[model samples]
Target: MTVTDQLSKVIDKTSRLIDLCAALQEENDLLKLENDSLKLSLESREIKKTELEEKLRVMTLARSLEGIQPTELGLSEKTLDIKQKITEFVREIDKCIVLLKK
Candidate 1:
């Protein structure tokens, strides 16, 4: 082949490669954006899950307290029991907070 023709072919190939590279770079950028969005969504869901779990724990504790009958245990005894239970729940919540911080 003539040197001029070979040079022309090389130029054409180089142009095509540059175009392909640009396209690939655009696709990579889009994928990176999608990955970041997904990570944010996952983090939001996990936070919601933790909140729901904490609520569930509180509800469970409330339900257990519901079984207490003030008539059966005198008023003062019932009050003391409730205070103790609340103190225990607070401790548990504090522990959970510490763990979450870690």
Candidate 2:
């Protein structure tokens, strides 16, 4: 081949290489932007997960209070007795009022 033809081929190849390099660089920049976006999404999801776990823990603690028994306060028997007496007094008053009306 002639020297001029060989140099022309080399120049053509160099131009193709430059184009490829620019394309690759642009793709790299796009990928970097996507990677940053994914990282932010992961961080926000982690924060939401932590918040949900904390809320669940608080709800669990609150639910635990529902099982407390009056016997634990040492007044179960006394309270029951008082409730019985109140019921009997109410029944007696109701009967007396009925008799008085008649």
TM-score of each: 0.64, 0.64
lDDT of 1 by residue, 19-101 (tens): 99999999999999999999999999999999879866765575478686555556564565577579889999999999999
Residue 22 accuracy (lDDT) in model 2 = 100
Error of 2 at 99 (Å): 65
lDDT of each: 0.83, 0.80
* lDDT (Cα, tens digit) per residue for candidate 2, span 1-102: 999999999999999999999999999999999999999999999999998797656444544564665566565545645755686699999999999999
User: Residue 14 lDDT in model 1?
Assistant: 100
lDDT score, candidate 2: 0.80
